[model samples]
Target: MKISLQINASPYQHQAADSAWHFIQAAILSGHDICRVFFYHDGVFNALRDSRPPGDERDVVKRWSELHAKHGVDLVVCVSSAQRRGLLEQTVAKKLGGYQSALADGFRIAGLGLLMEALIDADRHITFGD
Candidate 1:
């Protein structure tokens, strides 16, 4: 099945991000296709490249990057939401004189159009948080 996911909560602060990650892993193992993961609201924190957790703790951002690297899953951060939270894409950040590397690897910043496309294209659209 082709599945699309939306996450609205922040990593660590809430369980939604972690649950979405695990769900994606399980779905992939079951031979399912992940169409895209749309990060909205605080969920955009999952795409921060500079996120550094303790060595013992799992790095959620890195896990997301690796998911895109290994499985070719699309990790998309909502442009408006990210901007509200101070996360900007490379080009936009440069133009706005903001942090250039705000976004992590394998994740892209886009408008809601991509999210709508994923929802319309996927067989199932699962949302993990409010």
Candidate 2:
């Protein structure tokens, strides 16, 4: 099955991101394909490159990056949402004279059209959080 995920909550503050990650891992292990992961609202925080969780805790951002690296999953953060939350992409940050290294590896900033396309193309479109 080709599955796509939409996350709307921030990591640590809610269980949605953690649940989504575990689901993605299980699905991939079961021979399923993760087409994309669309991060919206506070979910965009998951892609922050400088996120530094404590050594005792799981690094959600790093886990997402590793997942993308290993499985070739498309991790996309909503552009408008990201901007609203101060999570700028490299080009946008550079143009705006903001921090140019905002997003983590394997994650890209895109519009809602990408989410819509993923929904249309995937066998299942699962949403976490609000």
Candidate 3:
């Protein structure tokens, strides 16, 4: 199945983001396909490359990168939402002179139009947050 997981909450404030990762891993292990992951609202923080967690806390950003590399997952962040939260990819951040690079290596900066296309083309759309 082609699964599109939408995350709409910040990574630190909720467990949905973590759960979504686990679910994706398991689904992939079980021979399922993850179509794409849409990070909206505060969930765009998950793609931030400079997110530093305490030693005891889990590294959600690293996990996301791993998922992307391992599964060829298309991690799409909403353009408007990312601009509001200041999530920039490395190239964009360098060109635009931002202090931080929010998008990880495998993630891409996209618009809601892509999300709409995914919704239309994806086999299953699962939202992980409110």
Candidate 4:
């Protein structure tokens, strides 16, 4: 099955991000395809490049990056949401003289069109958090 995921919560603030990550791993193991993961609202924090958790704890952002690297999953952060939360795309940040590398590896900032496309193309569209 082709599954698309949308996460609307922050990594540490709620269990939604963790649950979604585990679900994606299990789905891939079961031979399912992850079409895309759309990060909206506070979920955009998961794509922050400089998010540094303790070495003993799980690095949520890195996990998402590795998922994209290993499985070719699309990790998309909502452009408006990110910008609102001060997480700008590299080019936009550079233009504004802000942090240029705000997003982590393998994640891209885009408008809701990509999210709509994923929803339209995937067999299942699963949302985590509010």
Candidate 5:
């Protein structure tokens, strides 16, 4: 099965991103495919590379990066949300006149069109709460 997980909250203030991470990992382990993970609203913060959790805690952003590195799953952030938070992809960073965010390589700053596309193709479309 293919899944698209849409996140809507800042990762630190809520467990939505964390829960999505576990679900993604489990699906990968079980031979299911996660089509992509889309970050919207404050959820775009999940792709911020500078997030540092306490030594004893989990870093949700890092985990999302790991998923991108290991599984080739697309990590996407809504372009509007990203811009509001000062996040950008390579091309977008240049367009915005800022340094390319780490999200440049690990994730893509996309429009809602991509989200609609994901929904059309995915077996299940799940939205994680804000």
Candidate 6:
């Protein structure tokens, strides 16, 4: 099955991000294809490159990065949402004089068109959080 995920909440403050990660892992293990993972609203925070969770806690952002690295998943952060949260892409950041390394590895900043494309192409479009 082809699946795409939409995440709308911040990591740590809610279980959405963690749950989505676990679900993605399980789905892949079951031989499913994850077409894309779209981060919107507060969920855009999951793509922050400098997120440093305490040693005892699971680094959700790093986990996402690793997942993308291992599985070649398309991790996309909504451009508007990311900008609203000050999570600028490299080019945008450089142009705006903002932090250029705001996003983690394997994640790209894009528009809702990408999300719509995922929804159209995937067999299932699952959403996490509000």
Candidate achieving the largest lDDT: 4
Cα lDDT, model 5, residue 52:
73
Deviation in Å, model 2, residue 39 alpha carbon: 0.2
Clashes of each: 0, 0, 0, 0, 0, 0
Write down the lDDT that model 4 would get: 0.95
Write down the TM-score for model 2.
0.97
lDDT of 5 by residue, 1-130 (tens): 9989899999778989888888888889999889988899999988887677798988777777778888999998999988888877677778768575647347778899999999999999999965
What TM-score would each prediction reach against the true structure? 0.97, 0.97, 0.90, 0.98, 0.89, 0.97
lDDT of 3 by residue, 16-58 (tens): 8988998998889988889899999988888888778998988
lDDT of 2 at 50: 94
CA lDDT, every model vs. true structure: 0.93, 0.94, 0.86, 0.95, 0.84, 0.93
Write model 4 residue lDDT over 1-130, tens digit each, in one string.
9999999999999999999999999999999999999999999999989999999999999999999999999999999999899998879998999667799999999999999999899999999988
lDDT winner, 3 or 6 = 6
Name the runs in model 3 displaced over 4 angstroms.
90-100
Give the Å shift of residue 78 in candidate 5.
0.6
Better of 4 and 5 by lDDT: 4
Question: How well does candidate 3 match the true structure in TM-score terms?
Answer: 0.90
The candidate with the higher lDDT, 2 or 5, is 2
Residue range with the least summed lDDT across 10 consecutive positions in model 3? 98-107
